[model samples]
Target chain A: MATREIAGTTVEVNDEGYLTNPDQWNEEIAKVIAREEGIGELTEGHWKVVKFLRDDFKEKGVMPTIRRVKNAGGIPTKDLYELFPEGPLKKSSKVAGLQKPASCI
Target chain B: MMKRVLILGAGTAGTMMANHLARRLDRKDWSLTIVDQHKTHYYQPGFLFIPFGVYGEQDVIKSKREFIPDGVEYIEQKIELIEPDSNKVRLGDGTVLAYDILIVATGSKIFPEEIEGLKEDGWFKNVFDFYTIEGASALREALKDFKGGKLVVHLSEMPIKCPVAPLEFTFLADWFLHTQGIRNETELIYITPLSEAFTKHNCAVVLNYLLEEKRIHMETDFNVERVDETANRIIGYDGREIDYDLLVTIPTNMGDPVIARSGMGDDLNFIPTHKHNLQSKSHENVFVIGDATDLPSSKAGSVAHFQGDVLTENILNFISGNPLKDDFDGHANCFIESGFGKAFLIDFNYDIEPVEGTFPLPVIGPFSLLKETRVNHMGKLAFRWIYWNILLKGRPMPGIKTRMQTLGKRLPKIA
Candidate 1:
């Protein structure tokens, strides 16, 4: 519900710091958000998850679950955790500029 | 030549569908058959009460044969595979049941083996899941011997059946422990993979308040890595650990293995289903109901009951070469047990979150929504009678509607 500046780029974000508009996202914004999430850098594995979240959200109109990311995105859950430490699914989706994954509630 | 409708899994949904189609489809033109491996039809909601000593196994169990409508052939054998390409289902003994239409009602189940060390040394001793009859029975014994340290109730993953059961268990634990004079001694905790106690924003706020009021500790965004039996603690993906005297866990829930064997399911083995019509995404003749479908609705028995109304009509439509009606709105209402003979009733759908209001009546409900009351708990207890007598038989409940009512609901300005 608020706008924030990340790495000299402006984008709207929710209270949880998830980017409200995915179209406003760029590599610079991803890097800055990744840094905020305690992930120092974005590797090839990170972009693979990021790319899947972006494209899948575009097609499905909602954030895919962790199982979907692993099954369809071809990223093993272990590597996903290693790629984005702490919380892989939510963190990756945030860096990917997608909404938080809902629990069907 | 007579057309056949083969229903799978003979559970709550399938039995209802059989009863529905039996009354709807003329016996001269259509024949009905249902299949399952088990003869016992469990009142799944009653499982929550088992651990708290509210209900026994005999109370929840009944002959699956009791609810199945007459003239519908019931096959008490294993379902081997669903060959959607040929519109046939092969049974365990290699018998094939060919059908013009198929209804899948195979519900979700808790799989404890999905996590490392959960089903090992400490299973049923320290770690337990009340989703099954055996698990609940064993947990009853575990609860009996409780002096108490940290009683951690954890949710293993998302999209679980009876989404509110764990929360109910936690609240009931508080009440039970108080009765045993162990409330002060027990450090009750509720853990989840979701970012909050409950997923829906409006409901979460209310539930989180209840958790605080009951003094139950809240832990969020914790994806369990494994249960370390040696140390008697659960390790998270981030290496966070919480020790427990007793661990009541809702393990990974998945669709039946037959869905995977047929190569017709998603990652979780849930068949891809049309949310509105309850039709299979891949095959037109195959319809999915209950937890078998990958619908964004709670996988509770009440949802299966709601789906029963719409799916029956859609099947009748599909039978007569008519277009499938998009009448289902994912309407679901649940009584959330908060213990102490009090509960909260929440009514919601795909687009709307639960709001405060009267349910099924405008300004004159015997039960209130989003507010804990004894009437809601009474309603929940009364549902078991309804489930057995009316719901499973597919008889219409006069007061309830298939779609959600907006009459008494106080809608919030959703952002």
Candidate 2:
């Protein structure tokens, strides 16, 4: 684990840069993470996806996959890609302060 | 009063459960019955070889009744719905059967229709899935007639049954093409939703290098949007398109639709099962095994074989008024056929990644793990016999254990 200064706070993250301490995250951190992921200006559309990830992870104890985010989170697949291009779930979860979805090998 | 144990879907898991309980349960007190719509049981692993003409339909297909234990009643009927609350199952004929215990092994199926335009006119003609015997056979013929063009192997989603088969297919295809004297003419590509050749770190490093060595093109992080049948291409979420002359795809795999109708499955139609004990989260009398459950374990026959031991112990404990055993560690062992008369063996669980080491017999292992060997390839061929004679009969496989074994393995430090 490594520590990163994001949004003026020293928070811990994994080797992949996902937040190790999800509880330490706030909206400010999310915006910074999102910007780094090539997404600019968090719109209402983007917040919904982030909120869904946060809420679902809190309830299920695991980060949801792209299918779950699409099927259960009630977001269209196209909009998700449009909202956060290039591995949307990876970008969204990092911004949402959740660990990477452990893609089962 | 007599108790009835009902098993649904007489595939690998359910059939093994029937045989396991048949002898253990008292003949006078417990009655065993299994239900499935199909009469034939296909050796699913054999399907992978069918495309290369290593296995034929006759070799894989067998009567399901042959493996079922004596005194275990077999019902060849469609299960219409499962009523977990009432401890009953409704058949297609509107007949409801009460169960003291229910084992769901309905398994998963390839749903090509899930994607728009995937099941279009060119489905079997050009785009094919080898998950089924029909698709495998059709692909065999298609490969025979090929003048060698772009052969794209695609994975639509994750958690598909036999997770390694697509990679195996790509490797075998490379070998098959070379044998056909068309290796130079074929442009082979592997497209997946994963960011690399595999999700695990160690395996990915080795597999990615192999892909490069074999000159197979890699397209990663591409979640399929739809199939553009008119143009012979598949469009992903990023709007990236890959054209293919012959598309060998593993379509979105889902649990039986009956789970959806019964209002018990997740978004993918897999039941929410307890990862350790194999019990359904919501229903006490119900247990889930194999691909039907939404476990993190790979959906393969080896997993079902391991789960058989866990479920059997837990069910016996549950029936005897004892607490269920939360002893399953998700042990899964599979041989990755790498072609060129060589294969790789990987054994891991929910926690560990596939690392290099010797397996089963330890340091003196005739078959090495995570390294390609001809012995591993021989193991794959011999498994067909073991699968039918020993595995389905609930006979213990000599070297394997229910939980993941760390002995003889170079264990990785957990992150």
| Model-by-model DockQ, in order | 0.59, 0.73
CAPRI class assigned to model 1? medium
Query: Number of backbone collisions per candidate, in order?
Result: 0, 0
The model with the greatest lDDT is 2
lDDT of 1 by residue, B104-211 (tens): 999888888888889988998888999999999999999999998999999999889989999999999999999999999999988898888887888999999999
**C-alpha RMSD (angstroms) for model 1:** 2.5
Q: Assess each prediction's global lDDT (C-alpha) against the native.
A: 0.90, 0.92
What is the TM-score of each predicted model, taking all chains together?
0.94, 0.97
lDDT of 2 at B224: 92
Worst-scoring 10-residue span by lDDT in model 1 chain B:
B406-415
Superposition error at A79 for model 1 (Å): 3.2
**Any idea what lDDT model 1 has?**
0.90
Instruction: Give candidate 2 misplaced runs (Cα > 4 Å).
Output: A1-5, A8-12, B413-415
